[model samples]
Target chain A: MTASTQMIEEGTALEVDGLVKRFGDLTAVDGVSLTVRAGECLGLLGPNGAGKSTLIRSMVGRVRQDSGRVTVMGKAAGSTEARMALGWVPQELSIYPRITCRENLGSFGRYYGLKGQTLKDAIAWCLHWAALEEKQDDVAKTLSGGMKRRLNMAAGMLHRPKVVLFDEPTVGVDPQSRNRIFEMIEALRDAGTAIVYTTHYMEEAERLCDRIAIIDHGKIIAEGTNEELVEKTFGRRSQVLARFDGETAAIEAWAGRHGGRVKGETAEFTIEQAGEIAPLLDDATKAGLELEDLTLRRPNLESVFLHLTGRELRD
Target chain B: MIALKRDRGALVLSFVLPLAFFSIFAVIFGRQGGGTPTVKLIVVDQDQSQASAALVKGLQSESSLVVMMKPEAKSKSAPAPADYTAATAEAAVKAGDAPVALIIPAGFGQHPIAFGPDAGGSTLELLNDQSDTIAPQIVVGLLQKAAITSMPSAMADEGMKYADKYVGGFTPAQKAKVDEELDALRKAEADGKTGAGSGDSGNGNSGNGSAGAGIVAVNVRAVVGENKKSPMISFYAAAIGVMFLMFTASGSAGALLDEAESGTLERVLSTRVTMTKLLAGKLVFNTGLAFVQLTAMFLWGWSAFKLDFFSHLPGFAVMGLCTAFAVAAFGMLLASACQTRAQLGALSTLVILIMSSVGGSMFPRFLMPESMQKAGLLTINAWAIDGFTKVFWRDLPVTDLWPQVAVLLGVGVVLFLIARRVARRWEFS
Candidate 1:
């Protein structure tokens, strides 16, 4: 079979090559490049205004880049074949609020040219996949916040596209609802569907995505598996966590002087050797600080993410 | 206050709508174009006599009446059109050429005045369109005035003949006095001081629409809409139907703004559908909705009002579909031009209300001054209402609806094209 006819969830499902999109003086997406493989979930991590949504929009063919190439399932971006193969769940709740979940799915499916029995079956399958079978007949707005998010996602993939881009699918959702979304993504990956997930929640990226890419100012600054990124950023190193009893300002000053960061009551520092803890304690004691408890742990995706991206993700 | 101040759309709608409506009404009623509309009266003089000729000249002299003997020539070099006969004059009234027609019989000069209240023989026939209530009354009142003031010799001779039949014969002295009075009247008429110059008496309707005339035996006939249960039923059906159709279409078209706000437009565009296809789909849906609305409105008109709707089906269908297409395209244009629901609501209300008021939906265009009537032609409401009036009121055939059809279809095409162009903003980011 030719590449399009194959429709197999193997190899490269989507690719963006040297994409550049400028809006007047601001470059929204600049020279962004990546490959999303089938049966794998790629997490996109970015702080506010970091061009994550723009890059995803460009990949979904909702945006035209000033200079770039984007291919979906071996077809050029914005082509009929590419549009048919790609699914985009927008950052906003884009589903029709006045319509039933099934109807919303049916409307989107029809846009993709599904019809009759085929459309009905696609809607049914989407309901099951979104874990919304029981609420299929309910209007989308009447659903819970989490249910609305799932319906939005379900409408995007109603046609069973080989590649799907989920942009902040779990935004404003509770923890329980977010876990449900994680399960949904996991199920899709198990079924060999290619996924590009975007979120500000670092733990979601760690839990759902097989690989993570961090974009900042319209460029991909980092990309790898969670462990790979942490190792690459700070190789063979560990983070030391200590809770201190002292004035908040003094502890923060001490943490900042030692090339460490204070998060709430705890001060954290990365060290290559355990012996470095002795000097850290010695400095804390000299500063008239008392350590309540301490723990040694490896640096995580959050640390690596902030180390490269600067501002807080939610900001 | 702050929100209203910041929302420019609402602000404009609030201040501009009332002012615009007021201005439209002022222009229509304030006599800015002219004080009173001149009545168009067709004159057919079968009587080739001095008295009938004088009467024609007299009616022509009135500033408030436009008396036409024949249709205008197509061009300056074209042959003069034939004068209207009794048959053609009546047909003109039926076809809405002139609201009232005066047909002087062949022997009207011999018996111009009827001293008796109900005297018969060689009477004048006044053909009228009942829909224009004021025109017929004005014609009737002025016709009698012309017969009395214009022909002094005919009135004298008729009075003598009636006296000779009823009373004893007139004396020589009486005869001599009457002859001297006739001479003086003839001299005045010869010097152009008689006829229309006798008086500028006809400057308004005769205060009543009913046909009541004196000094001449006259038969009044409503040549059009005489059989309908009520006048203005079919008129209001078309008039109000088209006005509401405009409002409904604009509201329906505003659905695009709603979808855009909700982000469904972007999401749908990301699918296999292109912008053109999306707009085309909306156009079709809006057109269908508008057509259905028009059908329902007319059907309601038929059931409630005693309008003769069944016989005019073909003409209604032609006008209805064309009007529907135009209004639907109009809605699309409004939607495409506006960026938000608030803007669409404000803009559509302002525009549709102004168009309706100016286009004769609010009142008869004939009641307005000539210039305002011409301006009314620029509105879709005017064209659609005119077409329906031809079908239901004038009973014109479907073939006669070509002008309205051509204009409405053309407007629809142009508006739809403009809407398609404006909708390109939503195609991509």
Candidate 2:
């Protein structure tokens, strides 16, 4: 916990404040605020049309926000000066396929005002990092999907900016490649680069994020460390997964008495509460129920997000 | 710049294709009447001997003949008139080194006596190469005429000596008969003339026998100036230049549509690059490329077709500029209005091709029916090409081309403004 607090404070690489974008009457992004700090990986979780892409695009200057300030390295996002300090891998594999991988990196690096020896070094470094050194001379279209994904990441990081933006970089990638991407992201974080990652995969967010922001309908509904979010949402109650041989009427009476959310058939209802499994079992015995199996799960971020946003994370 | 350079295939396609077409078309179209072999001649004679001079003068008068002579060129091995043959003259002509060899055979003057009209002799020999089509005919005709004209005087002198020897006293009637016969012979010889002199007899022989009778006219120089090129070559040059300029512009304009589709244009706008700079770069590139295309095509014209392109270069340059402006503007305008690259390509190609066909890229406007020519004038290609012809083909002053130039430039300016407006809308939208 102490380490996470230190990470969060140091984690804030990109601080997006009150971000808003509108197309005519429709609001695509609305008042989304979050932080990606140094040495921390933040997962931006959302469904389709969840303003995830819009938020990322605004941060990268692909889409201009009607109102909001995105600060990268404490400077306004999309400013040449700020863009100079950040790397972005857009959701689309936005690369010129006719050109070679080395050419792609060189072009992207040039956009960051790198040239000469530095540009050359950046290209070589990226190719090595993407594990594409052997395929560097090949055209982008010839590479496999995973190789392309790796190249996309390498292109983003070519200039070695302070913060990197990955807009669903693992979409359509193989699981192995996805794992490799996570590893690379972890490696980048270990090197003190803040990463803002957006995806629809909950398990990925859960496994990879130091902190997570669950956005829906163009706004962030909940954001915190995974444990903090889960504990905060379900702290008063914990989910008790128990299988009991009992009368339906007796279980109903027990649920009514205990005042927790009871789900499933009368023989078994998982009660969400914390700190009193014994009391529950004793009460059940007094009611003449044979409790066969029981287990407890304190809520995780997935549950917290689902609870706060009222939608399944995978949905 | 690095990105642009990295896309070498695109750069090559953009620049190389037009140049290749220009080279090939230039060689084909520039050829003058399919490259038939011919020669031109200039002759100088110093010998005053009637016979010696007549031989030299005879070859000099030949049409399409290349004749050059000097005191130093007269070799000791000159062939006799009896020995001279068509094969000898043809060999000289084919060799193309020396113009024509004059072999004034020994005793050439004496042969006429045997073949005089009164003598009834059938053997009189003056040799030339009849195989050298134009030159031989002119030379032989002139030589024969000179003999006939001088022979009469010679005969009159001989008659005096003979009559003095035979008749001691002459009757007036005998002298009258002789005079009448001489006049008749003179009349007969004068009636048998040929060559270009036969058409304009007034210019050929109107109280100016010496002037008309000369084999070659002195102080003659042919000037092929501006507008003096063959109608076919002139029209083709102008039409091809205008057509290719349009193609170049349309291609660049189509690039704008590509940029828009790829969202590259939006990306560019997001940067510090402004629309004006972008448009300017495109136009400059297009215009410069068009100029290069024009120059290559004309160099072909000049080399193959005897096209006097240099004389009309100023006019061609001006016409090219106007045509380039019109095409560039029209292309950008088309791009601005079209939402996609496919639409832009199809629409611009259809419009430009139709204009080129009607306006005389495929054929000359003059060859078209009068009504079609009138219709062609409405197309910008026609106006632009016609302006070029007025300078290069009609030999008209460039000042006379202003109306067309003004119209073309006006259209270009209007189109450019419209295109700018459309591009701005697309950029923001």
Candidate 3:
């Protein structure tokens, strides 16, 4: 898989190396290196104010970095060629509320030097892709929050760029809107448009991202496929917690039977399967130890992040 | 088009507020000023003669004043009219309200010829509170003429004595009549009743005057443009226009701040929108709106009065463009620096008021001190309105507007560069 991924360059969709950005004395994005390959969805996961927005902005040319390079389709970001080859759905819904969705799309397309027939066709394609054909003529301000988010997506795609970047796209939205956004992103990615997605939602990242980079405090702490991240933490094992209301010796006997060391007064241990948790709890009960409760935690991106950062994924 | 549609309310208000202000000015200063202006005059009649009475009558002709008959009384002790007081009136006039009062001293008619026509000692005392600046000036002219006309024949006779002194001779019979008059003057002088014996006290008997001496030569030519409409109109128009325009500009630029707050600017930026293109779009829209507003005001001025809009079209165009460009650039600059709509609103209000006030929007630069007028030239409103007046009132050619246009354009360019610099900083940081 690694050899195949390396062999298929297919014109690097988006690439950045050693990018550094600073605001006054504060370093926001420090020596971050990243890439989004063609036809792939790459998710950027981080806590609030962890430089996710700043990194995305730098990639799109909305921000100019102090050092390093960003390129879209082998061209520098903010250059005409790079901008033409890239689409952006910024974290904020930035359409003019009083203008119709069609007008907003038209204006955005025109900014990319598209006009007349080409512009019209682009608007039509965006509306269809976003499933907003019926709402094209409605003023953006009048649309529901979900529809507005969808229209925002359509606008970003109006110029038909090969690479698209969504910065916290599903943030501050309803569950339905978030799901719609995710579906739209998946559809775009499946159509072979490379996407760089940033989100604080670990679940969303795990579900949607082909590869993910976990960032904190202006640095990428880890980056890999979801399975790779999970393995890095769980190591072919599962976590089980058993509540105890008795002396430590009884829980220790159960831990011995499970082939795991008892770590906490709460009698926490790790096993390779859920069946191990029940047997350990029964043994503790038989030894006259009160087995108050039992729980088994599965290996996921959240756990991987917790192991890496020593903090929960969702703030 | 999108920008305009999004800011419909703001755009409408920008145009409406200026039109409303223009209408208010038209109604207030138009041919029907509603009523006569009141001017208070303190009458000091030392002569206590019929001639002085006529002068007093002329002073009372002005409608503004409730004439105080005392020589010198404290303004505080003497109550003003119930509708408005002298203090408030002065403040209002300074603030462009038309209230004024005059004080005529006892010797005003007594010594009409005390000072030469060109000398500084011309003593027709008019103590006005500067409430209504124009009123004092108009009443001063009227009183000067009335006082000259009301000078008693006795003073005229004394002026004739100086003429006779130059002429060098008199007949015996004329001398005899002068002697008879001098004896009557002596008798009246003894009784200290000069008012009762005016004719008898001719200059002869005192030997300090001559017969037929009072034939003073007076040359007079009517001055043009006097007693015309209020001179305040030009300054007033400029003041009202600039004030309204500043409000309009500030209100319109507030839309930019709104875009920033609502995240629309960010969205737009995300899509291939450069700061230059965005600013260009805003400038074009705002300039067109400013022109339309100016045209409406000129039309309203014409219909309301004979403002002669066609004659001043070229000048109007230049001034309008200069003003529009400067204001548009200022708006852009403000939007680039400000973080939110509320902050922009507060900042704009402060900026506009300062600019308008110092730029001769609230007061005429001509009425201001020389230093202030020199400083006023630096303000965008002063030059723009001055150009407008040159075109509208002075009937000058469009070429003359280049100076004003250049200053305004320079200001616009400077502001545009500042806005660009700030915008770039904002985006990058």
Candidate 2 residue lDDT tens string, B1-429: 786576554454456545544643453344323322122332332223343444344334433233544322455686423322434443433333232343343344333233223442222222222222333333333444444344453345355546755679457887777778766654543443222221111111111212112222111111222124353676777788788778777877787777666544544443334577678667767767776787788889889998888877788878778877777787778878887765566566666766787687876654344456677887888888768766675566678779878989899888888888877764442
Candidate 2 vs candidate 3: which has greater TM-score?
Answer: 3
On lDDT, the candidate that comes out on top is 1
Q: lDDT tens digits, residues A268-311, model 1?
A: 88999999999999999998899999999888888888778766
Off by over 4 Å in 1: A1-10, A241-257, A261-268, A288-295, B32-36, B120-122, B159-168, B195-212
At residue B37, what lDDT does model 3 achieve?
Answer: 32
TM-score of chain A of 2: 0.79
Measured against the true structure, the TM-scores of the candidates, in listed sequence, are: 0.93, 0.56, 0.68
Number of the candidate with higher DockQ, 1 or 2: 1
Predicted candidate 1 versus true structure: per-residue lDDT over B1-429, tens digit per residue: 999998988898889999998988888887634334678989999987777888888888777788999987889999999999988888888878888898888887777777665655357788888788877777777777777777777777777777877798779998788778877876776566764554465345353433334676667888899887879988888899899999898998898898899888988988999888888888788878888888888888888886787888999999999999999999999999999988898888889989999999998988777788899999999999999999999999999999999999999999999999999888777
Off by over 4 Å in 2: A1-13, A38-40, A62-64, A73-76, A109-115, A157-159, A236-298, B1-230, B244-329, B354-429
Query: What's the true lDDT of residue B215 in model 2?
Result: 26
DockQ of 3: 0.35
Please report, as a residue range, the 10-residue window in candidate 1 chain A with the lowest summed lDDT.
Answer: A1-10
Candidate 3 stretches greater than 4 Å from native: A1-9, A23-26, A241-268, A273-292, B1-238
**By summed lDDT, which 10 consecutive residues of candidate 1 chain B come out lowest?**
B203-212
